[model samples]
Target chain A: MLDRMKQMQAALDRLPHLRRMGALFSETVLIKVDGQEFYLVFEKGRIAQLLEGPSKKTPYRFSFVTDEDAFEEFWTATPKPGFHDIFAMVKIGRAEIMGDILLLVKNLRFLKEVLALPRARREVVE
Target chain B: MTIEQITGRYLTVEVAGRAQRIYFEEAGQGRPVLCLHTAGSDTRQWRHILNDPAITAENRIIAFDMPWHGKSLPPEGFMQEEYLLSTKAYMETVLAVIGGLELNRPVLAGVSMGGRIALQLAVHHPESFAGFLAIEASDFQPAWYDIDWFHRPDAHGGEMGAALVSTNISPYAPDTERANTLWMFMQSGPGVFRGDLSFYTQDDSLVGQLHRIDTAKTPVHFIVGAYDFTCTPEDARRTAEQVEGATLSVMDEVGHFPMSEYPEAFRPFFVDGLARMPSAGAGAS
Candidate 1:
């Protein structure tokens, strides 16, 4: 899991378009995987820190929670229909997005692609 | 590249008591297959099937750009009102094009919105066509995404449509075809995608009406991609199970835009399904 998160960070660093899209973005997003929660704090477009949760002070702009199996399925090269996309998982009741949707909608493509970094191969990432 | 096998032409059809010029393209020389594209897109979706000699040799692949889409222009009256496609208007235009062309009971093949309309045709006008090919379609799939974003001034319509569509497609689609699908959607006209959705995402449904489709008289076949969560294979399976003589197949590594996003993978199904449809009856319902 740590390796994949590192891979995601590395890939995001290389993609210029994502950064540009979220140039005005600066907010923390709480991510819950199964029973574990992680604070993904972002300054502008770059992720500032990935703090393991149970922290009481970090206020997030939004939250993206996923079932462990759904997250695993989503990380696959070619995920199944309901598990292929974040929105797909949401529609099928496997994923949830809570809190203010303004930033989320504004950078929908960005957030979606960012969460999908683990699946995007090295060749496609560059 | 000097000469092309496909030919494009424009014909005048009267819809809503006004003369409308509609553009359509055709290839091959045998039985006619009327192709319909998804919302926010045009006839170019069928380009691959038309170019494939194997499918074209036995089928006359005909595709048309609905009014205000692709090469088809909107009627005169210059932009006083917003364009929103209703079921009645959609049905009228489809019938007008078919009647104006005087096609002898062509088999109808459509994807997405086209696929939904094909389901409508099967229920209400079964005798009009030989068979119905509803790809990535089912009885009803609600518009789960934000519809206002499609034409909102703050958002770029082209980019939004292309981006949303990009997510719906299978990752296995070839890069070129994926690029083509995005490009075609990006070129959509203003309010076009939203207007097209007016009919597709409406509160209406064909759930109970599907029983009216007599497959022996006019076959109804469904080919849904496994990656399409909107109109999942499970949805098509449920619909097919209820209708006698109806058939369905779930394809892996394919998605919403099967006919466009991955025509290579979609070819075998198109060809085999093409043979399943018989000739149409004398009159259209």
Candidate 2:
């Protein structure tokens, strides 16, 4: 799982459009995979830090909470309902988003593309 | 709930001065509804609606295959060439069917390419339809996704476009449903998919035309699937907001083909939209 997250981070780093869209985003986004947590600190549309574990020193502005299984399904090359997308999962009560609406909506596409990185990687591997 | 029995028939209709044999299906017996299919898809997309006992009990549900689509054969002398669907010809065909059938101000429900035409039909002939229900439609595609690669022949000289679309179906869809969707995609004739895209992505531009929509005359409702990347919920909402009295709803856990992708899951939203239509008959509304 950690390796997969790392791969996703690497994919996000290489997405050119994310870099352009990320210009509007600058915050620490938290992703809770089951009980574990990670922080993706964005700096000038780039993932400055993919910090593993929680930080008593730093705070996350937004967070997504989902189980490891749901997260895996979401990142799979092809996903089914209850896993196809963040919004889809939210509708089926599998995932939750906790954060400012303005921030999320402002960078919705960027965040969606970033989260979809693993799918792109999976496709390439297939 | 009991499933309604669906009956299909082929009617000879005059379209663009040509006598065309069109295939159509219907169920239930109430206010009439003319359902249209998505691009490269046939009446099968509305199987759920056509078979829903609740909808059928209260509404006359009808679905038809466009010329050059499904069981409908291409026009004479054009069978050897690629089937190209132009907006003008598409609309003319639809209008001809309505007139030939003498459907009285029936409610119009459509998806993708069908949805775009519903909007056009409403604008040009508002009094013709009681209400419009459009899914996966917008004024225009904001950007062309470069669909040329879809038509490129594979190693076996077969177009891979349909295969590409088959993959986009939500992974969570029922195995049988997914298989059916792939079957529909595979059944399409060569260049038919691209021909439909030409209208979906290019010829049909509803931009600056939303103002012409009179909700008082014909209420328009837009429903977009949550997982539809081609037409996002945000885009549908934005487009719906422009027209007065037009409502927008997002179907969750659904993708590009909501009704066919997950019929049971999609029926509630469909029913809800139908209920919102004032002209919908007593039991339906």
Candidate 3:
């Protein structure tokens, strides 16, 4: 999975417009699952770097994960009334949010928009 | 920076005469994945998965805010039926967007409402897609309405919506961070409320229509969170049973929003699923 993310970041780097505007711009984002955390940094809308350790630096962060069955239930169920009801009852208690909430929010849309872009076509490796 | 410039060239596509802002961030070079957001939530739900090493490395993902949600504006005469109608319209627009970008039959990945739209497209227009990933989406069941409405007054509407939005804001989140998630939900406006009500109240028996899906011709995988209250594991297992040869994976310790709640657990399932797609490289013929 990590390799795939690197390949994606490299592909995004090739897109001049996206790279120029720095769509994936952020100092770092720390995400924790269980007790572990992963730090991701974006340079010019491409994943510039990633670090895995006990701790990291970032202006914003959020963490949460669910077991197998609950994850599937979320996708299959009808759209719920609001986000909170969905997350609180469904999400596992393994989440933590820290740092600059505003900066994180400001970039939330952009971060999502970047991921929403189609994946790069692979060179047909026979 | 303004929202437009910050997100790159913002594409505005009119659906049902309503101008919806479609943000495109192109990456890699492959078939497109039309990403649909959950109700009340914009395309941001794809954040964790989109950046996952597996997805970016293999396939293209196109995510857009549904009508009446996110930066996208609602239709002029927004009605209950329009939600379903707009979903169809969105699918058409997505097809156009893919054609405009010169990609072939791409996979469709949707969560919650997005999953329903994907299912609708798959059953009605199977040829348009090569594969499907309906994460945490279940066949519409009437039993969902069985929740005690009186005891959970918020389940119906109004303050309930407010509480729903609040969950996205982590108390651990910085003040500004919480505010931004709240703002995005708020930007969705009353249309968000109506959309949720429509989904909650509608008689969507999509599960009964599982036979319409050509599982062999188009590989379909259903990923669900085990403890999801809305679309429980039993619901997913039941739906999978109906679809001949459909693949089902129940992630333990995860919830409805696995992409956000448990990206690592969900990442492998997506990567393996996409890798297994027969037409991963079959661009538009």
Looking at model 1, residue B63 earns an lDDT score of 94
Candidate 1 wrong stretches, greater than 4 Å: A24-27, A41-44, A48-51, A120-126, B1-4, B279-285
lDDT of 2 by residue, B27-139 (tens): 98878889999887788988878888878888999999998788887778776676667777888887777777778778899887888888887777777778899888777
Query: How do all models score by TM-score?
Result: 0.90, 0.69, 0.57
True contacts kept of each: 0.30, 0.12, 0.15
Docking class of 2: incorrect
Candidate 2 true-interface contact recovery: 0.12
User: Which run of 10 residues does model 2 chain A get worst, by summed lDDT?
Assistant: A117-126
Alpha-carbon shift of residue A10 in model 3 (angstroms) = 52
Every model: Cα RMSD to truth: 3.1, 12.0, 15.8
Residue pairs clashing, model 1: none
Candidate order by decreasing TM-score: 1, 2, 3
**Cα lDDT of model 1 by residue, B201-267, tens digit:** 8737676888888888888888988878767888788878877889887789898898888888888
lDDT of each: 0.81, 0.75, 0.55
Candidate numbers sorted by lDDT from highest down: 1, 2, 3
